[model samples]
Target: MVRANRRLLRARYGRYEGGPDPLAAPVDLTEALDAIGEDVMAGSSPERAMREFLRRGGSDRAGLDDLARRVAERRRDLTRKHNLDGTLQQVKELLEKAVLAERKQLARDTEMDDGDRMLAEMQLDALPASPAAAVSELGAYDWKSSEARADFEKIKDLLGREMLDQRFAGMKDALENATDEDRAAITEMMTDLNALLDAHTRGEDTPEQFDEFMRKHGDYFPDNPTTIDELLDSLARRAAAAQRMRNSMSQEQRDELDALAQQAFGSPELMQSLSQLDGTLRALRPGENWGGSEQMDGEQGLGLGDGTGVFQDIAELDALSDQLSQSYEGSRMDDLDLDALSRQLGDEAAVDARTLQQLEKALRDSGTLKRGSDGQLKLTPKAMRQLGKALLRDVASRMSGRQGNRDLRQAGAAGERSGATREWAFGDTEAWDVTRTITNALTRTAGEGGDTTAGIRIEIGDVEVQETEARTQACVALLVDTSFSMAMDGRWVPMKRTALALHSLITSRFRGDDLQLIAFGRHAEVMDIEQLTGLDAQYDKGTNLHHALLLANRHFRKHPNAQPVLLVVTDGEPTSHLEASGDVFFSYPPHPVTVAVAVRELDNSMRLGAQTTFFRLGEDPGLARFIDSMAKRVGGTVVAPELDDLGAAVVSSYLSSRRSGGSGGAGEDFDGMFGRGWGRWG
Candidate 1:
C-alpha cells in the first residue's frame, strides 16, 4: 500500500520537480518603421503651407513671375557688362595687330634689312598676337596698345548704343502722335523684332534669316546692320542673356508666372516684344541711341532710311507708349480693392480658408500639447477600445488559425465526467444518430400517447445527441521589458503593439484563460492591459526578470490544473537590483547577484510547473548565450527573431504550441515556426 501511494504521488507531481531555463531572443524594430514612414510623411496634408504661401503674396505664379523679372533684369545687366568687356578686349587685339602691321610697313618704308624685318615679324608672333588671346590679356597690353584698342572699340560701342537710343526716341514720339490702331500695330511689330533678335542669338534661328525675316515683317531692321561682325557679337551677347533666362526659373515657378500673366492680360501669351523692348530701352543707361546716329553722315543717314525708316520710328514710339500704359496698369493694381477680387474668386476663398483651418486642427489634434492647455490629451474610452481591437486584428493577421472550424477536440487532462444530451441547434453537427433521436422522441411520447396518432409527429425538441468539448486552461504571464534602453532604441512601440494584441486575444477569444501582465526594468511591477497603453520607461534601471517570474509564479500557484507560461520581451540582460542594505546594486554585464536572483526565479518557476519563453531585442551575443543557458536549465524556449518578423514569429509560436497539445514545449514550437530546431538542455 505504501509503494502504491508513492507511485500515485509521483505521477501527480513529478513533472514539477525541475525548473525550466530562461530564454532570451533579441527583437529588431527599426527595420519595420523604415517601410511605412515615407508614405505617412508624404500623404500628410500640404494645404496649410500652400495657403500661407499665398497669403504672403507668394502665390506660386506671382512668386515665379517676380523671380523671372529679377532674373531677366540681372541677366540684362550682366550681358551688357560682359559685352563691354569683350569689346574692349577685341579692340586691344585689333590695336596690337595694327601696331604690328605698322611696324612692318615702317620697316619696309625705311628699307630696313631683311633680317630686321624678319626679326620684327618673329617678335610680333611671339607676343600673343591672336585677337582672342590679346583681348583676354588686355591688362598686360601696353598703354599705347590699350588706348588704340579703346578708340576703335569706342566707335563701335557708340554706334550701337546710339542706334538703341534713337529707336527708343522714335517709339516714344510715334506713341504720343500715332492713331490708336497704328500704335497697336507698331507695338506688335516691336514685339516681333525683340523676339526675332532674341531667338536669332540663341541659335534658335540663323542670324541672316532672322535679320531678313525681321526686316520683311517689320520695317525696324531695314538697314541690315551695317557691320555684320558687330551684329554677330551683339547677337552673342543676347544669346547669353537668353540662356540665363532659361536657367533662372524652375518649371513650377514658370507655370505660376504664366498663370499670373493670364489673369492680368487675358492671354498670358499676349506680350508684345516691342513694348518689352521699349521697357528695356527706358531702363537702359543714358546716352544710348537706336539709330546709329553717330556712325552716319547726313546723306548716308538719309540713304540708310528707306520709306520704312519713318514706319520703323513710328512703330518704336507706339511700342514705348504701350509699355507706359502697361506700367500704369501695374501701378494701379495696388489701389484696386482686393476685397473685390476676393469676391470674384468666390468659393476659392472659402475653400482656401477652410483648408487653412483644417491644417491648424490637424496640428492641434497631433499628440503634442498646446502651451496653455493641460499637457495631456486623454484618450477617449472609445479610442482605447479601438486600440485594443486594433491590437487583436494585428495579432490575428500575424497568427494562422482555422476559420469557422467548430469541431471539438480534446486538449487537456480529463476531469470528472457526466453525460448530457441536447436537441440539435442551428449550428450543431449533422452527424447526430437518427435512431437515437427517434428513440428519444418515441420514449417521451409513449407515456402521453393515447391521443398521439401515427401520422408521424417529429418535433424539433425530440432531436438529441451527445457532444463533449475539452477545457484547456492556461495561465500566461507576459513580462514586458520597460527599460530605458527599450524606449530609446524604438522597441517600445512594437512591444506595446504586441502586448496589446496578446491581451486582446486572451480577453476576447479565450476569456476563461488566466492572463497577467508584468513590467520589469530596474524593478518589477504588475500592470493591467488598460494601463499598458500609457506605459513608459522611467529612470536608468536594470531588468528584474527574476522578480517578474517569481511574481508570476505566486499568481499562478492557485491554478492547480492550469498550464503556466512566462513570456519576456527585453533588449538588455538583467543589470540592477535592490540589496539587503536597502540600496540598488548594478553592473554592466549583470553581476553574479543578478544572475543568482534570475536563476532562483527560474527555479521557482520550474518548481511550479511553469515554462518561461524569452524574446530579446538587443544585439549582445552574451545575453543570447545566457538566455540559452537558462532555457537549458529550465526546458523552455528562446527565439531571436529579426525586428521586422517579431509579430509573426511571436504569434506563430503561440499557435504552434496550442496545436501541439502544449507538451511538445516552446522549443518545438519555435522550431515549427522558424524551421530551425532549438537546442534543448536537461
Candidate 2:
C-alpha cells in the first residue's frame, strides 16, 4: 500500500495595507443630509449643521466624538497601567544571581587558601546594597566559577543592549550577546550620526551627505526616511518621548538608572554618545515636546525604550484628540491624520474618519450647499427640493401605513388639450403644437418664397402653442403655529416639516394650486417654502391665529376665481390677536378679545366658503375644546395626529380638501391659469 504524505497549509493575518478597506461600508449620504436638513430647519446654519452631523456620526459609523473618547481612554490606559523600572529590576536580579553563584563556588573549592577565600568573601559582602554599585565594584573581582563570571558579565551586556535600544529602537534584541566588534560598529555609527547632525545644524549639510549617511547606517533606522527633514522628524519624536519618560521617572529611579547607564558595555562611552545624540536632536528640532511628563503608577514594568514608545503613543493620541475636536479655527475633516490615527487606534478608526471626510466633501461638492453673497454657507435651491422630497416620502410612508396602503399622492387634474392652436406669446409655458407650428412656418415660408438654400426662417409669429381646457385649482393657506410654546413642546420641526411636505406636493404635482405658508408666532407673516423650512424657532409668547387667518382670507381674496382651502395647525388656544391699530395683544390664558377676534376671522373665512381643516397638536384640554369648537362652527374637519404624523396629517388633509368641492368659487372649470402664475417657481 503506497500512502502519500499530507502537507499542512498555513495563512497569515496582519493589518490591511491597502488605501481603504474594501469591506468598510460606505457612508449613507441620505441619512446625513436628512440630519443636516433637520438642524438647518431648527435654526442652525448650513455649515454648522453639517459639522454637527459629522461629529454625531450615524447609526453604522463612528463619529468624531466617539473616536476622541477612545483616544482619551487609550491614553489613560497607557499611563495607568505601567511603571518604568524594568531595566533596574533586571539588573538587580542578575547581580543577586552572580553573588550567590560566587559564594557557592567558594564553599565548594576545597583546595583554595583560607586567607584568599576569606578576602573574596569579605569583598563580596562589603559590596554596596545598590545594584549599580554592586555591579561596578564586581568589575575588578576574579571569579573561580565560569557560571558566576558569566552572570557577572551578563549585567554589562544587559546594560549595553538597553542603553543602545534606548537611543535606537530594536537594538536590544538585535545586539543580544553582542561581540566587541559589534559594539565598535555602533560607536562608529554614532560618531558619524553626530557629525551629520552638527553639519545640518550649521546649514552646511547637502542632500548627498544625507544620502551617504543613510547608505552607511540605514539599517539602524527601521523607518526608511528619504530626506533629512524626514529623518529628523522620526528621530526627534522618539528622542522627545525618551526625555518625557525620564521626566516621569521618580528622582530615586533616575539616580539608580543614571548610575547603571554609565556601566553600559563596561564603560561610560555609550551613555555619553546617547546624551550627545539627545542634545543634538533637541537642538535641531526644538518644536518637540521635550519637557512633558506622565505619571505611571501600575504594576506592569516598562524599560526606558518601551516607556518612550508609550509616551510617543500618548502624544499621537493627543494629536488625534485635537483633530477630532474640530473646534480650532480653520478646522476641517481633512485636518485629521488618518495614518497616525490608524497607528494609535486601529484601521477601523482610520476608515471611519476617512469616510466622514469623504461625506463632507461630497455634500459640499454636490451642489446641495453653497456660499451666499455674504460669504456664509447656505442650502441651495436644489437642496431645498431634495429635502422636500425626502420629507414628502416620509409623509407618504406614514400616510400609507395609517390609511392602509392607500395612495398618498392624489393626482390633480392637468386638464385636456383643446383641439385648437394659437400664436405663442412671450412668458407662455404651454406645450407647443409641433404640427401646427410647422404648418404655420411652412405656409409663411411658401407665401414669402424666401431663400431655399438656408434653413426655413421661422419667425415668432409662426410659433403656435397648444392651449388646454383650464382645470379647477385650489388656493391653499397652511397656517402653522410658531409660538414659543411650539418650540418648547418640540412641535417646531414637525410643523415646519408638515409645511415643507405640503409645499413640495403642491409645487411639484399640483402646479396650478397656490399654497401660502403663514407662520403665526408673536405675529403672522406670509413665508415662501424656503423661508418657512429654514425659519428659526421663536421665543415670543403668542399664537397669532387671528393674524394668520387674516392673511389666509387676503390670499383667498387674491385668487378670487380659484377654490379656497384653509388649514390651521396649532398646539394652543388663541392667546394673541391683532388689534385694529396693527398692534399685537398677547395673554397666557385665552383672552376673550383675542378669541373673539380669531373667531370673527374664522367666520369671515367660512363666509368666503373655504374648505377648512383644524390640526390640533398636544392633549391640552383647553386646546382640544377650542379646536373642536372652531371646526364645528365652520363645518371643517378636525385631526389630532401625533407629532410624528403631523406632516402626513396636513398633506392628507390638503389632498382631501382638493377632492371635495369648496364652499364657493368662480366655477368648477378654472380659466386663465395656464399663463397666470400657475407654478410656484413661475
Candidate 3:
C-alpha cells in the first residue's frame, strides 16, 4: 500500500476569559418544548405556557425567579452586614492622635515660654466633645509637633475627598494629597456640569456643549456616557443613592455629618457646588428613587464613599429584580439588561437569563409556534407532530411485551406472508426468497436468450421478495369526556395525551388509516389533535355519551369499507342525550330517558359492527356498573386504568382491536389480548 500523507496537529490550552465559549454545545430546546407543551395541554395559552416555563426553569438551570431571589438576598445581606459611621469614627481617631502627640511635644520642649505652653494646654483641653466640633474649633490652634499638624491636615483632606466621592465615584483615591489645582479643577467641573444641566432643562443645550464639557471633565465620570440622557441617568442614580444613604442614618448621625460637611476642604465652596449638582440631577431625573431608606443592623462600618457605593448597588439590584419579574406592562424578555445582570450576579445568572431569552425566541422563530390570524400564539402543525411523537414514545415505554418495538408499527410490516413474490421497491424491508430470485434470473436470461450458456447473472430487475398482506386500514374514533367531572377529577391532560399518542401512531405509521378525535360534554363535536390538546376544561354538567356514540356511528358510516375501532375515555355515566329537536337534554342522577337513549345509540353502534372499549377513569361505583353493562351489551371491553397509565391502556386496546381485524366476532380474542391485568372491570 502507498504511504498516505500525514499531518500533525498541535493543541494549546489557556484560561477561558469572557465572551461566548467556542466549545459550548448548542442550545437544546427539548426541555423547554416539553414544559411548554405540557402547560398548553393543561389549558394555558402558548404565550402563557412559554412564560411559565422560563419562570420555573428546568432541572439544570436557574430561572428568572431564582435570579430575582438571589438579588433580594444580596440586598438584604448588604443592609444587615454594615453600618454607616465609618467617616466620623476615623475623624475622631485622627484627632485624638494629633492631640496626644501635641501634649507630649509641649512637655518635652524646654525653650518654650511657660505662659504660652500653659495657654496651649488649656486650649487643647477646651476642645469640644464632638469630633466635628473639635475639628472646627482647632482651626486656629497653633501646633508644635509637625506630625500632629500633618495628621490634622489629613483629617480635613479625608473629609473633603469623601464629600466629593459621595457625588462622584473614585474621588477619594483620585484626590489623595490633592493640590489647590485639583480642588479648583473639581469646582470648575461642577460649575460646568450644572450649567449644562440648566441649559438642557431649558432646551437650550446642544451636542457641542456636551462634547466640550466631557472633554474637560470626562475623567471624573468612569461611566463615560456619550449622550445627555445616559449621563443624566448615571449621575441621577448615584445622587439618589447618596440621598437614600443619608436618609438611612439616625437623626443624630445625620446632624453630625451635616455639621461636618461645613469643614470639608476647610471651605464652604465644595459643599455648595455639590449641593447644586445634586439639585440639578434630581431636577433632570425626577423618577429616580430619591427618598428611600434601608435599615442597617450590623457592627461593621462603611465610610461615606463606600456607603454610597453600597446604596448604589442596592439600587441596581432593585432594578434587576424588577427586570427579572417580567410583570410590568409592555415588558419583554429583551428588556432584561444582560450586561448589568452579569455585573451584579456574575456570568452564570446572565447565562441563565440569556438562555431563557434564546429559548423563547427559538420557540417562535423555529416555526414551533406562530401567530395566527386571530393574533394569538398557536402551535404549528410541525410542532403538533413533534409533540405527538414525544407522547407516543412515552406510551411505548409504558407498553409491555414489546421490549424491542421502539417504533410504532409501520404499514406493510405485519409479517403475514401471502406466499407470492414481487419486484422490490425502495423502503421495502421484507425478506427475499432465494429460490424465487434464482428462478427469476434464469427465466429472464432465457427470455432474452443472452445468459443461458454462461452463468446466470442476477440483475436488479430479477430481484424479488415475498409479499405480505397489508393490515386492514382502521377508521378510529377516540371519544374523550370533557364534562365537569373529568376536569374536576384531574383526567383532562391524560385524556389529551392518549388522544395525541393514538393520533401520532396513525398519522405517522399508518397514513392510510382515518382517525377522528371527538370530544363530548353537553354535546359532541369533532376536533383535530391540536384543537383537542389545547382545549380548555368546561364546567358543563353532562357526559353525553349518547351524543358521542351517535357521532361515532356517523363516522363509521363515512368510511364503510374500513374497520371501525371505538375508544371511549370517560369519568361518569350518561347524564345527557341529544334530542330530536337538535338540542341536548341533561339530568343529574341518571334519568331513565337518558339511559334509554344512550343504550339505543350503543345498539346502533353494535349494528354497525364497531369494535369498542370503555376507559373508565374514576372510582364511582355507578360509573363502573354502567360501563360494565355497556361493554357486555356490545361484547366490548372495559378498562379502568390509573390516570398516568390511561394513555398506555387506550393505545394497547386500540392495537389489540387493530390486530383482530376490527370484527365484532373476535371480541373474545380481543379481550384475551388486553386481559393482562389492565384493570378490566367487565
Candidate 4:
C-alpha cells in the first residue's frame, strides 16, 4: 500500500511528496437522521441528541462499542505479557534444578582437586532462595547446564534492552548487534540530534542546519521526517515515554535499570550522549506527559532484573498515543496506525473514532452545520432543508406501503376546457396536460405550415391550458400538540413527521391551497415547517386547544372563499383556557372554563364551515373521552391512530377529502374514512 501510494504521489508531484491523512467521508443523511430521531424519541433534548449523533463515531469502520471491546483486549494482553507471578515461579524452578544439576556434575568430575570440588559445592550451596537475588549473584559462577546459563544470559539481555529501548526504538537490536564502530556512530548521531534541538531552541537553526544534520544522521530515524519540527516531535514523544517509564517503576527497579541502560551499547559515552539528548527533548517538549501513574496489575516481568520500567513505559505510551491520534485531530494524524488501533482499542471503537472524525470533517466541509456568531453549532439553511427532505422522504415511504399513481387533478385548479388553444394564463400552476394542448397546437400549425410558417409552427395561439374537474381550493390548518407529555409518551417525533409530510404534500402537490401550522401547548403560536420541526416540547401546564382552534378559524377567515379543512393531532385534552384578557388559565382535573373555552373555539371553527378531524394518540381515558366528546360537538371526524401510521392516515384522509369534494361534513360519517375508521373512532 505504501509503495502504491508512493508511486501515485510521484506521478502527481513528479517526486514522492507525501501529505497528511485524508479526513473521513460524510455520513449518509438517512443514517445520521435516523440516529438523531432515535435519540430525540428517547427523550434527549435536541442539543443532547446532536451530541449523541456526534458521539457514535460517524464512520462505518468502528464505534464506541468497538472501542470498549478493544480496551478490554488491551488490558488482557498486558496481563498476559507481563505475568510476573507465573514468570517468578518458573525462574525459581529453573534455578533449583540447575543448582542440583551443577552439584551432580561436580561429583562426576573425578579429576578435580578436593579443594576445587569443595569450593564448587560451596558456590552451589551459596545460591540464595530468592530467584532475583540468586540471578544477581550468578554473574561469576560457572553453570553445569549451558541451557540454564543461556536462559539466565537471555534474562540479562532482556533486562538491559528493556531499560534502553523504552527511550528509543531499535535500541535492543543495536545493543545486541552493534560493534564498537556502530556504538561510536550512535553516539555521534545523538550528539548531532541534541545540537540541532539546542540550535532550534535558540532560534539559530535554519533549514540548512536541519539538512546538514539529517544528511549526517538521518538513518537513525526511519520515518524520514521532512522538517526539523517533525523530527523533534517524534523524539519528544519517545523521550517523554522513557521519563514516564522511569516514574512508574519501583525505586529499586529504577536503580537497577539505571545501571543496565549504561551497558546497552557497551560505551559510557553513548549513554551520556543519549542522556543529554533526553534532557534537550524534554525541555523542548514540556507538554508531553511527565507526571502520570498507571496501576501495574502484577509484577510485570518485562525485563529480567527490572523490565517493570519498560512495561510501564509501554503502557503509558500506549495510553498517550491512543488519545493523541486515534482517529482524532492531530498535527500529523497520518502517522497513526489504524490497524494497531483496532488491535489495541478494538475494531468497533476504531471504526467509531474514525467515522466520528470523518463526520466532523464532513460537517465542516459541507457547511451544513456551523458554529454561529455565538460559537454554538447551528444548522445552516441547507442543512435544515436536507433534514426536512430526509424526513419527508421517510414519511412518503411509510405512506407508500400500498399505492397507485395518485390523480392530482382534484388538487389542481377547477375548470372545464372548451378543447381550445390559447396563450398561457397567469394562474396555471399545474403541469401542462400535454395530450390535448399539443394536439390542438399541431392541428392548427399543420394548416398554417408555409407563409411565415416556414416551420410547422403556430404563434402564441399554439399554447393552451388543460382544464380540470371543478373543485374549490381548501384552506388547511394542521394543529400539532407540542406539550411535554407528548415527548414523555414518545409521540413528539411522529407528530412532527406527520406535519412535515402533510406540509410537503400540500405545498408540493396542492400549491393552489392555503396550508398553515399552529403549535399549541401552554399557549399557541404560528410556525412554519422548519420552526415547527425544531420546536422543543416543554412546559406542560396546558394543552391550549382553544388558542389552536382560534388560529385555525383565523386561517379559515383569511380564505373564506375556499373550503376550510382542519386537522388536530393531540395526546391530551385541553387543560387550559384563555382568559378574557388573553392570559392562559391552566388546570389539571378538566377545568370547566378551559373545556368550555376549547369547545367554543371549535364551535367558531364549525360556524366558519371548517371541516375538522381529531387524530387522537395514547390511551388516557380522560383524553379519549374528551377528544371523542369534542369531535361529536363540532361534528368532526375522530380517528385514534397508531403513532407509526399517523402520517399515512392523515395524508390519505386529506387526499380522500379532496377527492370526495368535502363530502364528510357535519353529521357525515367521517368515521367511514376509506371504509375503515368511521366505526373505530366513533
Candidate 5:
C-alpha cells in the first residue's frame, strides 16, 4: 500500500523520467528562509533581512514578504519548541529591571561617594558626638551659607598671618645657595613634612600624642629642611603604623564605619570646610604671601574681590550642574517623541508610522533606549540598528530594478545531462530508469515476478547516468571607476548599486563562473563582490583607465580559456599614469601618451583572448569620441545607457557575449535579454 502511494505521488509531481526530480530539488526560498531565520534569531529583524534580500536581487516584494513571514513563524515555532518563550520573557524582564535599578543605584552611589568620603572619615573618627559639633571642631566651613563679607574677613586674616612670610623668607634663602643634589633632597624633605603636617591636621595620626605635638609645632616647619632623609624616615614610620590600623578593620566593619560617617557629615558645611582648607594651603606659597608691608586689599590682591570670589566658590556648583545636565541627556530616551516623529515622517513616506513605531519598540525592547527623569529619549545600540536598517532600506529601494541580461544562477554547479546512455555510475542522480532496470531483470528471469535464479543479466540499457564533463565555464572582471568625477555627477552610488547587483547575480546564479572585482581611482586595486555594497569612491587625482584595464588583464591571465571578459564602468576618460621616470603624468584634452597607454592595455587584453566592454555614465562628447575610437580599435562594444536601461543593458551584453562563443562581437542583439518573451513597458 505504501509503495502504491509513493508511485502515485511520483506520477503526479515527479520530474521527467531519466531527468532531474523537480519536486525533490531544493528551492531558493527554502535556502533563503533558512538563512533569514538564522539572522533573525541572531537579533536581526524582518525588515533588515528583507532589505538585505532586496540588495542581493531578491527584488520581488511578495516573495520576500512570504519568506519574512516564514522566518517569523519559524522563529516563533522554535521558541515554542525549545520551551524558551516564557523563560526568555521572564529573563528579559528581570534583566531589564535589574539593569535599570543598577544604573540608578550606581549614579546615586557615585555622586554621594565623591569628596564626602573625607568628611565621612572625619566624622567616623569623632564618633559618639553630634555631627555639627564634630564638624565645627574640625574647622569645617559653610562657604555657601556664610555671608560673602564673613568669607572676605576670614581670607584677610589668613593672608595676614605672620607664619606665611617667615616660611617664604626661609625657602628663598635655602633655594639661592643650594647645590642641585641638596636642592633635590630638601625638596623631597619638604614634600614629606607637608604631607605629615596635612595628615596630622586631618586628625589621621596614630600614637595619638605625636599628632597633638605636630599640630602644635607644625608652623615652625621650613619649606625645605636640611635634615631631609631623617624627616622622610620619621614620616614613613608614622604612615606604616596608620596603614596597619586601617588594615585591622574587617570589610563589613569598614563599610559600616563609612556609612555611619556619611550619614553624619555628608553635608554642605563639611564640603565648605575642605574647600577653605584647600584655599588656605594654596596661599602658603612664596608668591602668594600677603603678610608683608604691602598690607594688601583683601578683595583685589588675592584674585578674590567682588564677584570673582563668588565665581570661584561656585565653580564646583557649576560643574555639578553640568554633570546633572549630561546625566539627564544621557539617560533620556524619550526625546524623540514617536508621535511627533511619525507625523513628521508622514504616512505616505517610504518609512511609515507603523514601521517607525516597530523600530522604536524594537530599540526599547533591546535596551538601546531608556527614559530619563525629565522624560527625554536616549539612544542605544538597538536604536542605532533601527536607524541603520532604515538607511539601508532607503538605499536598497533606490537601487531596485530588473538588472543584467544574464540569468542569475545559484552558487553551486547545476547538472546537465547528455542524450547518450552510459553504464550506471555510483554518483548518478536517483531519477534514472528504475522501471527499465526492473523490466530487464524480469525479462532475464523469463517474466517471472519471484525469480531467484543466479543467471539474471544486468544490461547497459538499464544503466542510470549523470554528467561527466564540464558544461559551462566563464571568467569576468568588473572594473569600477572610483574617481572623484563619478561623484560629481551623482553617479557613484548608482555605479556601486550596479556592481552589487552584478555581483549578486554572478555569485548567486552563475556560481561556476569566475568573478573578480577591481576598483580604480588614481590607482587600481582588486576587490571582492561582497565588498561592493560598502564601496565608496576615492577623492584622488584623476581617473586612470589604463591602470585599471592593465590590472584587469593581469587578473584574468590565469583563466585563459574560461571565456574571459572585462566590464568597465567609468564616467570619464583616462587622465593619469606613470611615466618612464616613475613620476605621475596627468593631462586633459586627450593627451597622445594617455590615449596610447589606454589602447595598449586594450591590445594586451585582446592578445590574451579576453573581451572588454565599457559602460559610460553621462554624455561627454570628448569621452564619447574616445570610447568610440577604443571600441572600433578593440572591436568591443560601448553602451551609453540611461539609468533605467542599465540593468537590461548589462544583462544583455553579458548573455550576448556568452552566446557568441566568447568573442568581442560588435552590436550583438539582446532584445530578449530579460527573459524569453518578457516585455518592457514603454
Candidate 6:
C-alpha cells in the first residue's frame, strides 16, 4: 500500500496541472434529491426542479440565467464553425469569373465567327443564373487563371469523398494516401452494407449475418453495437443527420450537391447506392427526429471551404440536442451524449453532465420516489423517512449555536424505571436486561454441567426481566399553512423544513409516536408523511386553522393513549374559518364571526389537553398579538422564530415537552435552542 501510494505521488499530471479539472465524481443522490426537494418547496414544479438540477448541477448559487449565458457561448463557437456563407460566395465568384473570362477571350479571338460568339455570350449570361450548371458546363473549358482551377479542384474534392464520408463513416481514412485497391474496398463495403439492410428490411436476415458484417467492417462502425437493433439505430441516426443536413441547405446549396453527385468519383452509381442505403435506414427507424433548425449567431461569416465537416458538426449538434431534452418519466439519463457535450462545451462540462446523469439514474433506481397509478411521481414511505432524517440532522447540527458547543441529553421519558429484576411476568412492557438474565441462569446452574460442559441452563423460574424507563407516545399534528402568502413571502421552504425535522425526530426518537401532517390553506386536509414532503403551496388565500384543529381532535381520539402535541407553523393570522354548513368563509380584517369560530376550535383543543406551540413566521403586530393571545388562552408556548432557525426552535420545543411533559419553564429551553434570547421574538 505504501509503495502504491509512492507510485501515485510520482505520477505526473502533464498539461493537466492547471487545465480543466478531470477529477469529476458522480453526483450524490442524497444531495440531488435534497436540492430537488428544496426547489419544489420554493414553488418550482417537479419538472422545473429537474431541469434546474440539470442546468445548475451541484452548484448552490448558479441558476438558469447562468446556464443561458454558458450555452450562448457554446452557440457562438458553433456559429463560427458553421458560418459557411463566405466560402459559398467565393465558389460562386470563381465559377462566374472563369466562365466570363472564357467568353471574353472567345469574343476577342481573331478567327471567331458571329454564330460562335453568339453562342459564347448566351452561355456566359447563363453562368450566374445557375452556378452549379455553369461549373459542370465549364469542366472541359481551359481556365485563364490557374488559381480558379485550383479553387474548383478544392471544391470538387470537398464535395466528392467528403460528402460520401458523411453517409459512410471512415471513408476519409480509406481514401487517404491510397491506390485503386482502397477505393474498391470502400465500394465492396457499401455494397455489402446495402445488401444487409435490404435483407433485414425484408425479414430475411439473421443475427449471424450482422455479426459477420461487423467482424468485416467494424472499423467503419466505432460504436461497436452489440445487436442488430443497435446497429440500425446508429445507422438511422447518421442517415437522418445526413438527410437533415440537406434539408437545412438553401436552393443553391442543393443544386451544388446535385452537381457534385454528377462529378463524384467518376461514378454516378455511388450516389445511387447511398440513396438506396438512406431509404433502407429510414424504413427501419422512421421515428428519428429529422427536422429542426438551429441558428448559429455570430457577427462575421466563417471559412468552411475544407470538407463537409461543418455539415457533420451541425448533424452532431442536432443529435445532442435531442438527447439532452429527456421528457419522459424515468427516462434513462445515461443516454445523454457525453462526447458531444464535451465537444460543445469543455471537458469540465461533460463531467458535470455525467454527474447529473448519475444523479438522475440514482433517483430512478433508489425506489424512494415511485410513479403512482396516475403516472405522477410520489414519494414512498422510505423516501419520507430518508429526507426527514436528513432535515432533522441539519436541525440538530445547528443547535450547537452561539455557545460553540452544548451537551444534548435525550429528553426525559414519561415513566421512570425501578432498576430491579423480576421473574418473567405474564404482561410486562419493560426491556429485558440480557446480561443480568444470563448471569442469573449461570448462578442457578453453577454445578449442573452435563454433556455440554459448563453450559448454563435455566427453566421458567430463573428467567428474569429488567425494567427501563417507560416512553411517552405523543400524537403530533404539524399544521403547515400552505397558503399563497407562505409561498410569496419565502416562508414555504422553512415551513417544510420545520415539519420534516420534527417528524423525523418524533418517529426516530419516540418509536411509538403518531405524527400526522395537516396542511391548512383555503381548507384544511390531513396528508400522509409522503404527501406533506412533495405538497405544493396552494393559491388559496385563507388560513383555516379551525379545520386543522378539528382534524387534530380526530387523531387524538383515535390514539387515545397518546398525548396530543399540536405544532402550528403559519405566516399570517386566521383569515378564514369553517362554517357550520361545511363551507370555508374567508375574511380580510379578521371577521368577528371568523375569530369566534377559530377561538371555539382552540377551546376544544385545550379541553382535549393538547400541548400547543404556535410558530409565528411574520412580524406583523396584529398576527403576533393573535398568536400570543391564543398561546395564553391554551397555556401553550408562542415562539416567533427567524425563518432559518424555525426548524431548530420547533425541535427544541418538542424535546423539552418530552422531558417536562409540556410544562415547567419552556421559554428558557427554546431560548437555549439558538443560544440567544427569544424573549424579543415573543
Whole-model alpha-carbon lDDT for candidate 1: 0.49
* Candidate 5 TM-score to native: 0.38
Tens-digit lDDT string for candidate 3 (1-682): 1233232234456746666566767678788877888899999999888888889988898888899888999889999999998898898899999999999999999999999999999999999898878988888889999989989998889999998888888999999999999988988998899899999999999999999999999999998999999999988888898999999999988988888888888879888888988988888888999999999878889889989999999988988988888889767788888888988889889889888887777888999999999988999888888888888888867763333332334324344787877775444567787888888899988998776778899987778878765478788899999999888988889999899889988888767779988999999899988889999989989989889989899999999988888889999998999999999999989899999999998888888878888998988898899999998999888888888888888887777677678544433343343233433422
RMSD of each: 25.8, 11.3, 7.0, 8.5, 25.5, 11.2
> Which digits, one per residue and each the tens of the lDDT, describe model 5 over residues 1-682?
9999999878755324543234442223423333333233233454354334332323322232332343344333322333112211232343334334433443455456656645544443453343223223334422222232233233222222211221232332233333546534544444544555466456564554344444544443533333333333333322322222223334543343233222211233322332333343443322321221111112221111111222222222233233222234342222223333223233232122223223334444555445656664343334333433433333333332334322222111123544433445322332455656666666756755555465666665555443222245668887888888876666665565565556555554456678888888777778764344335446776777777887778877878768777788887888886566756677765478987888898898877766667887787888888887887787777888776555445554655565454533623433332323334321
- Expressed as tens digits, the lDDT of each residue in 482-573 for candidate 4 is 87788788888788878877876776667778889999998899998767766776756679888998888999999879888889999888
Q: Which has the better TM-score: candidate 3, or candidate 5?
A: 3
10 residues in a row with least lDDT, candidate 1: 296-305
- The TM-score values for the models, in the order shown, are 0.39, 0.84, 0.87, 0.73, 0.38, 0.66
What ranges in model 2 sit over 4 Å off? Answer: 1-26, 402-404, 410-471, 588-591, 663-682
Badly placed stretches (over 4 Å) of model 5 are 1-470, 530-532, 580-583, 663-669, 672-682
Identify the candidate with maximal lDDT: 3
Write the residue-wise lDDT of candidate 2 on 98-119 in tens digits: 8899999999999999999999
User: On residues 196-218, what C-alpha lDDT tens digit does candidate 1 reach at each position?
Assistant: 55564454756576556546543
Global lDDT scores for all candidate models: 0.49, 0.83, 0.85, 0.65, 0.46, 0.69
Task: List the lowest-lDDT window of 10 residues for candidate 5.
Answer: 300-309
Provide the lowest-lDDT 10-residue window in model 4. 669-678
Query: How many angstroms is residue 588 displaced in model 5 relative to the true structure, after the best TM-score fit?
Result: 1.7
Candidate 6 residue-wise lDDT, 254-372, digit = tens: 66657756755555677788788887887788797566444534444433322234545666655565566555565556777777777766776666666666666667678755778
How many residue pairs clash in each candidate at the backbone level?
A: 35, 0, 0, 17, 20, 0
Q: For this target, which candidate reaches the highest TM-score against the unseen true structure?
A: 3
